[model samples]
Target: MSERTTFQDQPHRTVLLRNGTVHSPADPFATAMVVENGHIAWVGSEGAADSFADGVDEVVNLEGALVTPAFTDAHVHTTATGLALTGLDLTGVRTLADALERVRAYAAARPADRVLLGHGWDASTWPEQRPPSRRELDEATGGRALYLTRADVHSAVVTTALLDLVPRAREISGYAADAPLTGPAHHAVRAAAYDSVTPAQRAEAQRAALARAASLGIGSLHECAGPEISSADDLTALLALAAQEAGPRVTGYWAEAITSVEGAARVRELGAIGAAGDLFVDGSLGSHTAWLCEPYADLADGAGQRGVCHLDAGAIAAHVIACTEAGIQAGFHAIGDAALSAVVEGVRTAADKLGLARVRAARHRVEHAEMLSPELIAAFAELALTASVQPAFDAAWGGDDAMYARRLGPERARTLNPYAALLRAGVPLALGSDSPVTPLDPWGTVRAAAFHRTPEHRVSVRAAFTAHTRGGWRAIGRDDAGVLVPGAPADYALWRTGDLVVQVPDTRVANWSTDPRSGTPGLPELTPGGPLPLCLRTVVGGHTVYAGPNE
Candidate 1:
């Protein structure tokens, strides 16, 4: 067998890439590129690249491929994603029995004492419209500890044994002994449920997730971690691993609600980029935990249950101000009108207290700005707030009859995820999968935004792609990435184009582009509901992270 090579074994090597259709408006005919000293040194025609390769350590033939800046997922839970990859994958489980059967099989395969950690359980789609009960889990596991997070990760069904570990869960407002714990109760039990996942397990899972990401042409991820979501050690370990390995780059954001300078110092000490990303202002719409101005249309009890507001406006303002004064970003997870309203008010308060320029310069962000009124959208634009959005949420549940419509009324549902409105309002939109909630597919995300359920809310394919690529970098306060240029970081992906079709902003049907003379070139036909480009290789900072099956 051939010996495997890593960047550590071969450092400071120059790579010459040629015979590729580079995606750059600056130089249309740029078919070759040079990566020297871990950065893009030159980009031009193949004829010019040969001369530059004279003193290079390696010359890579592109074999007539397409190259563009590698993708970056703005919001991701690395450990959760990795665990889902390696643990019980409950995605697409049609019936409750199927889910139980899978869990039973998974448990049998692994050690009995090992805590069963599984994700992606959506009862709404199940035949029974109900998840496996605690009794069912206990029966399946023979009293083993098991915890499965709902698709939204806002609720989870835990085995009695695991619930025993977090006795205080019963005191939580949304707690139930046999039912799926949601809101604060879910948060309380989650840590106890994941007690068995050691540092080694987390590292393994992180590697598994990053490897998959690299294979799919993703070069970076903004890890959304916090006290409620994930432990500080988990974030630190993942960051340390990324620094040491030739994997996708990871930027950490600690989402703990900051109330003191000591907390801010601790966040910095833990190597967090900011006190941002998933600092929950509210919960998810699917779980009915999203704080909304109006009560849910499908509420069985009454019209009183709007949702839960984990963080009040005062808390939001305090955290924002703290992060701003410390020259860091402060973000929150908001998905409803009420939560968005509070966020806007908090942002306004922070801006008033701190200078507007300082607030804008901080470039704070909000995750899942799903339900935004025109006024709120305008507020975001005026504040220069970064809308860290997930298109897959709309894709999975945004149609008139989908989950959003079912939860809220059709009229209210129609108002969700107004991608075009946000874009028109000049709100900086950053597209992410929020994976394990949604699968990590950039093309899917872009497609979802372009082909929005609400036709009027659809954004241009170009705009959606930009949001996924460029907006992601800006969300993390990194300007050196996202763009493909000599000065930009050497983070890009090579692909073999299946079909060439240029999708205009206004049109549904894509225009064909086979000839070089066609002013605009078609890199890959990401037509509505079509397969995305097949990645050939992914490169991050001049290091080969993933090579495709054929390569």
Candidate 2:
């Protein structure tokens, strides 16, 4: 990996980039952009570029590349993402046997490590239709301490040797001897697993994850860290690294609920933007732990199994009220219908207590809001809450025969991730990868939203792109960045792409917008199986963070 060159360390220079398709609202047909002093100074056509050509310090011929605002992944686990990128990644493993074999190899290769850590194993896709048993894991790792999380990161299957690290794990809720751990049990084991990582390994992982983000044209990351999810030291270390480096900006959110001014102060002291991000209201659907209004279809004990609810309406209301009064953002991780409903009810209550306008101004967010009803969507709009969502979830587990249908049945599954409805209701939408849960593929995320499995839920490509870019900035209470317009922060990416065109999900509105006279800026073709754009360069605040092989 290359070292980042900070903007302050280098002398300021005016750069004129001409002969490229600049995606800017200032001029739809803009072919040139000027960057100076870490900000966009100008954007216009090639014909008008001659006026400032001689005055500029440097000029580059783009060779017809596409320049657009870089992406912001609204939700991520930085350290965990890095670990998955550099360590054993079972993201696409096809079978349980293959997973075991990989684990055996990884364990043998790293014999000096205190704990074996790996992520992205979805047993639902395996032929055996289950995760490896404790004994199977023991045999694979030669009775070593191993901790492997499922794809959702909401649950995990651990070897007995690792389980011993948390003596009370067996007595916690959502613990089963033969099954994967969930709830407090999962948190305990995950903490133990991460605690075993040395500081050097942790810093290396953070750097690796940020570098990967920059390579994919992601310029900002909203790290979802919490006491249960990750330690305060972890969040502080990641933030320090980002500040010292010229990579993507890292905004941390400590996911601990607060009910008092002092509680909010504690979160601010931790270097977090808010007491939000992954403040879990429930678990995940794949783990059968997402708090739902109805029982899971595949559960044998369906009558009582409605997943898990970590926080109630009262707690959510208190946290929101406190955060609002403290002038900080508050967010939650809610996936199932019951969990989303609780969020809505709690926010509504907070709005009632602290005037509606005051609450909305705080721009509180809700993460992974997949199962939303028409009423809930209305509430989100009324409260002006930003939906920090990962479209890749639907692409991975959606459809009639996928894991969603198996868990929630086809009917309820179709109701998940209603992006179009949310947009129609005027609710803000911010796209993300939720890395380790889903890989950091920005273009793939846009494609998934534009070409949703259930057609009714699909949004336009332009809408999806904006959600991944400007929407992320808006969610973090900034409206001046994440765009290529003059006066905006110089955070952008240059891409080697195919033909550029305006693509929409609705056929009725496509004809008018696709016409060149529409004045709409075009993005790279994002057809389901087609090639996505390749990032040639990623720049953050006028500093080049990632340069492709060609550059």
Q: Residue 244 of model 1: what lDDT?
A: 77
Report the alpha-carbon TM-score of model 2 versus the true structure: 0.97
RMSD of 1: 3.5
Local lDDT at 383 for model 1: 92
Clashing pairs in 1: none
**All candidates: TM-score:** 0.95, 0.97
- Where is model 2 more than 4 Å wrong at Cα? 1-10, 301-304, 507-514
How many clashes in each structure?
0, 0
lDDT of prediction 1:
0.85
Best by TM-score: 2
Per-residue lDDT of model 1, residues 1-551, tens digit only? 23434453457678888887877655766888888877788888878877987888888887888888888899999899999999898887888999999989988988754688999989887869888888999999878888899999998988888877878888877787677888778888888876688878888999999998999889889999998898988998888888778888888999888867887888888788899888888888878899999888888655438898888898899999988887778999999899999999999999999889999998999999999999999999999999998988888888887788989989999989898999898999998889889988987888888788888898876688778887889888877778777788888899886755555556545434456776554557676766788888998888888998876
How far residue 61's Cα lies from its native spot in candidate 1, in Å, is: 1.9
Pairs in clash, predicted candidate 2: none
lDDT of 2 by residue, 1-551 (tens): 23545444666678899999999989999999999988999999999998889998889788999999999999999999999998989999999999999999999999998999999999999999989999999999999999999999999999999988888999988689889998889999999999999999999999999999999999999999999989999998898789888799998999999999999999988889899999999999999989999899998766449988889999999999999999899999999999999999999999999889999999999999999999999999999999999999999999989999999999999999999999999999999999989999999999999999999999989999999999999999999999999899889999999888988898666522446788999988888798999999998888889999985
